[model samples]
Target: MWSLWGLLLCEALLPIVVISVQVLSKVGDTVLLVAECPPGFQVREAIWRSLWPSEELLATLFRGSLETLYHSRFLGRVQLHSNLSLELGPLKTGDSGNFSVLMVDTGGQTWTQTLNLKVYGAVPKPMVQVFTAATEEAQPPNTCQIFLSCWAPNMSDITYSWRREGTINVDVELHSLFSNGQVLSVSLGLGDKDVAYTCIASNPVSWDMATVIPWESCHHESASGKASYKDVLLVVIPISLFLILAGLFGAWHHGPCSGTNYLSVPDDF
Candidate 1:
């Protein structure tokens, strides 16, 4: 009998624990927070309130009628579904906080749940700029040093990562190019082609990416090709000048048999 009394006393003083749920949302997006209760707990009334930024009662739903009353800043932007879930929409950064739903069953048992909302703005598109590092005349043969810097302007709390789609060979390891935080330093060969690199900017809510091909922007011409072009210009210029001079000489002196002029100046007179 003493054991039974002690067990009853322990049950009477048991503390209620509210379950916490985490939620992520982007700005200008709608989110639904469902009020979860026990399966057999017939809820007679449920009250939803904001617990952060300031404590305020947002809405209440009764059993018989499906009516809901909104409060404060959530007047037109909050709605209730048939399942006692709250639909909050077009969320702003200020809407990030804790919300609680209290459900009272018909037998007077109360269940509370807290939803932690984290609202973040979508990540902006990253811009990548490539810079060529100047090298001395005594530098390594066929080596081109470059730096690719990735950034998103006017953004805070953003993460940056990189993705390389092509290969780089400088007699060095591939991981050596990634030591400079958001700036990737790569030593590529002059003949390297199709080397594309992408920069990824991300937040908890969204991500954006930008790609750049450094090889294509730094184009090269072969020494043999340049020499051949110079040789062609040298052979063509003199020939062109000679043809122009011959045309002028032919216009100035005409053959005697061509007979467009008569030089019989008064000889018969």
Candidate 2:
């Protein structure tokens, strides 16, 4: 019984040098890999290597030095930090791999750790497109409702969301209402008060948003209101002036101080 337990323990402890790490990155960005060492032990040497996509030796360093000797393709893009960490960057999609580091302690014992890196491209701002049945539906409508779609060009691994007035809630999807991850439709009759729509696009590296409204149509409404006011003034002003002139003429003809005796010399002339 003890023999089986001992064999299991030896097998489990053997090749246990690997400590795996996971990370996500974008192109033209940096990724760092770290090796943890127990305190009070001086590192005599350190070596970083890539295991997946090919076994390539990437770097080696000695104590009391700052520079890391790197592979030919990795030159000028890798650096060593004080805490026994390696930084590789302005990354590329091909840089995704399993990175390992081996350390030699003061007494010359060897140990290692590994990292798994995954890379993606950065996402740009989303462009929102809206559609409606009404003519000139380009703008948001106070009378009707619409459909909206968001597009993030030249990007992958993206997700989408819809919002209104900067608030997110279950009601955002409930007003005669419904929304897909990237598309949405709503109606004004629902009394939803969602004056505007916003689309948010996201990826592992970044996220952005765009908003739309029908204010141009509202602008036309304001102009119409101003035109109506001008029309009312045009009619009312002439009518008011005519009334004033007629009143003056009637008073001159019928008032107590009429034309008969006000200027007595006019009859002699």
Candidate 3:
């Protein structure tokens, strides 16, 4: 009867539970995750696991001591802290997942919580891309509009923004609904030909920027490959000079006057 009464009393009192989240870690870095417990409830044991790639055991702790790290992949890479929190070092893309913590308190009360880990490469230098253009004849001077997009490869959840630099007073209108005007589809005047626009790509961890001048972006590739008159003249002039000098040297060395020697004149007093 006493044992039954003690079991009932134990069931009535449950340890308070706390869960933590929003842990962000970059690739090739360490991330610390804590499984917190309320006061009066001592952490007796804990088990860390994941369901992101089916069932997998990460590590375990007993009485604040590391009991085992069951997964071979995490054998040398995992550390169990005194508070039963887990520290994963040198993170990789494969480390992203939904992880769970199963904690048992001293009173035999158990608590569970899950967190999502996202690991990604640092943001790359963004590239600004131009999509369309209009000539001055088609539109009024400085009324030519172009579309621009900022791209950072392999990055997710990025926030994009666009701003113009220069005194052309160009209009940049952001798309209202979706990306909050990250992409610019606007027009600029002929007087704005030298103006540059910058695109910014950002996330919770980092940001990158790229700049573009609309008037030059379209012709950038084509103009680079074509030879100019100045280049042709530079090549032709040097070769022409070499040929002329060679002809003069040959005439001096082998011409009619080459072998002719003047008769010696007697010295007159």
Candidate 4:
């Protein structure tokens, strides 16, 4: 009688064992693997062995079991749950590989499913650059024409515009607004005066703007001819005064000598 009861109990537990093993499955970013155990049996431990393991299994397995006896050698492993979801955080290029999930039953039965994992890395940031006209020597009036431009290293599809400093005016006179960037040129007239100007470049991904001011553009030549005339008058006035003094001295000395000779001649008569 006891033997018959034992046989009946074994039969009842068989279906449970099968159901437990069938429910083991997981979804991951890089890989998808499913593990199953018998219905009546629970997973005592889970193990994963990878041909090229990125991180140690002991460190990667947070919630699930990682026992030596239950551990299985696979490219990837995931824990079994009612709704199995494995979020392989921030995947790298090297994370791509074949993966499998191993679930060990209390009765020592193991089940595993193989999956192929493809990892995709995130895109890199775009490179930005500022372009401008050539720098020239400082002229007398310090005036020159300026050109502003912007570009990206690897990206071709971009948009650009120009902005001026301390003004509400937007510049629309661009030489060329290419698929990559834009170029703007303006005739900057400068003197000794101080002023400011700016250029702005932008795109969908990023924006870069630069400002420049040729302060010498505002200079005006103060009436230079009037200054030259005043200098000439200063030199001529001093020379005229010296000539008048010399003539007066010669006349005075000769007049005295002539008067003395006339008086002596009258005495002889």
TM-scores for the candidates: 0.68, 0.61, 0.64, 0.26
Model 4: per-residue lDDT, tens digit, 118-181? 4433222333233324345663343445444544344333455555555455454543444434
- The segments of candidate 4 whose C-alpha lies over 4 angstroms from its true place after superposition are 1-143, 154-156, 174-181, 191-201, 214-269
TM-score winner among the candidates?
1
Q: How many backbone clashes does candidate 2 have?
A: 1
lDDT of 2 at 112: 71
Assess candidate 4 and give its lDDT. 0.42
| Candidates sorted on TM-score, descending | 1, 3, 2, 4
Please report, in order, the local distance difference test score of every candidate based on alpha carbons.
0.73, 0.68, 0.68, 0.42
**Model 1 root-mean-square deviation:** 14.3
Clashes of each: 0, 1, 3, 26
lDDT of 1 by residue, 117-227 (tens): 998888889999887766669778777677888888877778777777765453323534453347887766765666788888888889999999876544432444568
- What lDDT score goes with residue 160 in model 1? 76
Return the TM-score for candidate 2, rounded to 2 decimals.
Answer: 0.61
- Model 1 spans with C-alpha error above 4 angstroms: 1-15, 66-68, 136-139, 167-181, 216-269
- What digit string (tens of lDDT, one per residue) describes model 3 on residues 134-183? 45565764365677877788877787877778855545553221355456
